[model samples]
Target chain A: SQQGEEDPQALSIQEGENATMNCSYKTSINNLQWYRQNSGRGLVHLILIRSNEREKHSGRLRVTLDTSKKSSSLLITASRAADTASYFCATRGIKAAGNKLTFGGGTRVLVKP
Target chain B: TAGITQAPTSQILAAGRSMTLRCTQDMRHNAMYWYRQDLGLGLRLIHYSNTAGTTGKGEVPDGYSVSRANTDDFPLTLASAVPSQTSVYFCASSDEAGGNYGYTFGSGTRLTVV
Candidate 1:
């Protein structure tokens, strides 16, 4: 079974609108990271928020982690057509060995011009 | 930095044949991982190596094997392909700590077992 799961399998919005995606995990984690994947390409690391941190910002990306609820959310401000892609959330467990990242079922976002 | 590279962008194999997918990372990351992505399903870890000469199974390890003979290379093998195994295979690398830096993924290899 997958440790992390993303909600809202797909989303569609206008170019300038903000898009939000949520992820929930079942175990205690040291950190949570978000990634973007374009068609035919590999995933690109976007932002990582530690368990102790409540919120983080990078460019137009905003990530919030609520360790108490074991969930995280990614908010993309002023989205663009170029930002249309699949977003995935990965969880790194605190006591897990190695650098294993358990990914969730991604949410595909489509931005219309 | 070349990052991570995977070979045979796409491949088609018979159900009973064997094949090897190659992955190499120029970053010299201490940890490397193999994952498979299917439609509607996120990437699932197949195998991983924390360091040279040590490999461990991930969420889904059946029908797959990996070897880390050197720091720069990690290859995954399928000893008898099945249609159920057809999916996009990704190779990723990360620093020793694994969590803080996130992961760097390869371009991915699309495999089809018929």
Candidate 2:
């Protein structure tokens, strides 16, 4: 089942611009992760933010989690044309039977050079 | 490291034909999963195996089957292909079950049913 849903089905931006995407989930989660997929290929793990943590960062990627709101945001700074891809937010809820992850509908981002 | 690898990167099959998508990981992860991604929709789970010899159905498992006879391999089989079954299939594996570690996904298999 789908637990998280991303906002802004698609976005287009110029290279070097910052890109931000939001995800909202239905239930409490142990942690939230963001993944990047290129051209329908396998996903690459970007960053993960635990429920207890409010924010986390990796290089140019920044992730924030708000348990009270059951939402999260991913920010990619200095976006490049190569960064154009689909971003998905996956939630790992405490109640998940076996640590299964529920992925949200991804946000398609296009970085035009 | 090889990480996760999926066989038959792309395939075209006639309706009613049966095929299996192969996934393997060198990570020795205990949890493996099969998910299908359709246009405009998020990836939906088809099946998962928490460990070798244990399997469970995910959200969509009607025409699909999975087996985890060993830790390194998890294959998804389509008993009978249907037009609606065409999508990009991804295989993922995690070191542990919960959210402790991130998942490693395979390149993906693009299957088209005609």
Candidate 3:
């Protein structure tokens, strides 16, 4: 089951630009996580924000979670070609244990040189 | 460090046949999961285990079963394959249940059922 939905199914940006993606979920969650995947590759964990955390940062990435709104956003600063990949949002529910996450369709981002 | 490994990077199976996809995690994580990825549909969970010797169904559990005999191994089985089951399968693991911690995923197995 898909618990989250991401907007801007696809995105194209030039190098040095910032990229932002938004995700909305249907249920109350324990936490929300972001992942990146290159073509034909496994997903790499990017960052996570607990329900109690309104904002968090890792390197050039920033994540904001709004439990009241059941939404989250990921921001990438100074995006480069290396940042070109599909970004996914996953939600872990309150009742679910062991990281049984429900993933969104993902946003495809292409950074042009 | 071989965080996670999946066997048979890809496979071709016939309808009504049976096959099992193997997964192993060296991280000694207590939780393991199986998910199928399809174009435009994203990744859907099929089964998961909170610890060794336990297993539970996920969203798309039909036509799939799983076993977790130890912390290092989790395998997904298809009793009877079907065309609709063709997709890229991923195996993931986390340090604990309730998944506040992020997961580490395998490269995935590309399965084709005809």
The lowest-lDDT stretch of 10 consecutive residues in candidate 2 chain A is: A91-100
As a TM-score, model 2 comes out at 0.97
- Give each prediction's DockQ, rounded to 2 decimals: 0.77, 0.72, 0.80
lDDT of 3 by residue, B11-109 (tens): 999999999999999999999999999999999999999989999989999999998888999999999999999999999999997647999999999
Candidate 1 positional error at A46, Å: 0.5
TM per model? 0.98, 0.97, 0.98
Q: What DockQ does model 2 achieve?
A: 0.72
Q: How far is candidate 3 from the true structure (C-alpha RMSD, Å)?
A: 0.9
Q: Label model 3 with its docking quality class.
A: high
Q: Compute the lDDT for candidate 2.
A: 0.92
Which segments of model 2 are wrong by more than 4 Å?
none
What are the candidates' interface root-mean-square deviations?
1.4, 1.4, 1.3
**Best candidate (score: lDDT):** 3
**Could you say which candidate leads in DockQ?**
3
